[model samples]
Target chain A: MQKADALVPVSAYVARAALGRLAAEGSVKVSETEPDWAALVIRVRDHGDTQAFAALFRHFAPRVKAFLMKSGAGAALAEECAQDVMATLWQKAHLFDPARASVATWVFTIARNRRIDTLRKARRPEPEDLPWGPEPEPDQADAFELAEDTRRLGEALAQLPEKQRALIERAYFGDLSHTEIAAETGLPLGTIKSRIRLALDRLRQSMT
Target chain B: MTIRHHLTDALLMAYSAGQLPEAFSLVAATHISLCDECRARLSAFDAVGGTLIEDCDPAAMDEDSLTATLARLTGAPARPRQVDRPARGLFPAPLRDYVGGDLAAVKWRPVGLGVRQAILPTAPGGVARLLYIPAGQAVPDHGHRGTELTLVLQGAFRDESDRFGPGDLEVADQGVEHTPVAEADADCICLAATDAPLRFNSLLPRLAQPFLRM
Candidate 1:
């Protein structure tokens, strides 16, 4: 069998195992392909896979660093955050479960939280002085294969009314919550939440 | 659920971007979790995020950065660890559950009586922007000088033409004019995008124009 085909059965078994863990942990079930494969690899790779881990680090680390820097962190600080995020990935590799979230979603969540931490530390203000609570746990949303998944996701996103797409971007990337979104957009909060719920449902159905 | 009660397009976009306030974001996330259609839309938005990153001009990194990182990782000793503690505290657990995680770390500020606001520091050129507002206060009646996009994050409000709630997106032409008043019991929050400043109708509003570029 081709190397890819040869890996299928093992991948399937690993995916099932990971899913079991995720189900026990109360995370979302993996319903997509790339996440399933990546989860399998994560479960099987021993700590000795330094080279492979390094490759993952190389691809993701810079991106994480860039994201932080773009969001206002200094280069050095961004690098530190990125390093910490990758380190978390290395230490928590065993936790990767396709049933819970996609690889990109997981990685991005790590970066997102790290960025939040960095932001918190940059301030001289104490914990009591903080207005909002700490960041939420990263979503275990399903990950898609980079090439095809991205293409399909894009198509689906484009299919949404332009208004919906804009709101999702603000929510996911802009970090504005529903109330803030209402104030900024001059819309009712109920209307905003309803649209987001509908849009998310549509996107999920489309992907499946 | 009344389909009409569903979030508007603009609100959904904002929710996907993480731009809504905590109170309203929770509601949107909860609804999305139960609603497969919204989840699919959110996935599509994530794809768009991926595309934006792919399209963004790559910032130049030091030539040795990769090498330095690799060397450090290789030399680091392996240590047993648990997955990091899940985020808690900032928002109520019920709201956090619906958001697919990630609802803390935003900067919130009081914008008016009974209202607080926060600006999400994402996107470089200010082409995309996010803002949060609290309940009951009325955003002064105003019109956009250019195309403006707004998404409700939390609570509910009524403009002249319609009522909006969490996850609703409203795109206004330059000619649009209205005042958003929050619902009696809840605060209103939103994410808005505009090319130019808002045009106010009165003296106080005109005075505020310089301070509020929205």
Candidate 2:
């Protein structure tokens, strides 16, 4: 059914519904969707909830497109990549496990990996270089631990000094290498390294 | 796994930010799969990546993008829900894809006395490979011209800095040099990546360097 989805010039969501039906046609059982976006993903998986899938696409697609553009993809390529990524999210919704990561985290990881895959395809000729299928969930036993980390992560990021936070933003979102950042900020390379190290140490301490 | 050595905070941050080269990414992803602590650290970074993306200046998508995507989703194929209960091997799925199965399937060639290596097909400007060293064997003494990431898959190896065992990573830069000798009683295996050629100490290793592709 997935192979079929790739061929049709029609809408990808329609393709997904057909895929969902193909799955249901089998002997497998469908589960109920949860309350949040992550659960909505489950709905898209188990029942082909077009409404749920619509909500997710509306929320993530623009952000994903922008993210790719910042990561060096041209505007046209970013649009194309975002479309495919959202389609993959629907097709692979069954792989979602709320116990491991929140919906945003899961989606962003896919976005990040997908960008890498696209960039690599142009430069390298290897097919298997595409990371992996989907990630295995983090240990469920670490939920409490992960929650604490998540909570502290926000607080810790906010607590960073303004200058360090600026550096972090450039490093994280601007997708700048140390050299690029150093040039942009007009700071010495040593200064950039020290600031990043200090910020990471703070984050590490807060989480652990 | 109790990994004694690890990728530096800087490298992990680069990996999390999607700025690391392809080979270095393989090292980070493989080690992250084996070590929960590092994996957790990386996930935290991803959360930060999420917030950063959301805060980015919004790009205006096409009017039909959403409607088109939704239409495509309808025919999306269903992926199987059953995940591997315990993730059945030492290597992660990415590594297995490159090596084409598990440890036994690897086609290793001799690099030195009791040392074997198989170079992976990585993007240009970086070289990635699998190295298997028999117990008590020592890799040649060398300093790095660029970054070298060595993530141990099995057994242990000790260098001038410290000991590295399974899931442990040694991130070497231009300033570092050492002889890595595998632990006794068990062979050591690693997924290593290098951005530049090594600076070997002696003539013999240098003579063999071209053949080893180091």
Model 2 chain B, poorest ten-residue lDDT window? B196-205
Off by over 4 Å in 1: A1-48, A91-102, A120-147, A152-208, B1-4, B54-93, B96-214
**What is candidate 1's DockQ?**
0.11
Best candidate, DockQ-wise?
A: 2
lDDT of 2 by residue, B145-173 (tens): 67788999989999887899888899887
Candidate 1, residue A189: CA error in Å?
A: 23
Candidate 2 chain A: worst 10 consecutive residues by lDDT?
A122-131
TM-score of each: 0.41, 0.71
For all the models shown, what interface RMSD does each have? Answer: 9.9, 7.4
**Candidate 1 residue lDDT tens string, A92-183:** 66555343334555566566556544563211111111111132222234333233454444456557677865664445444453334542
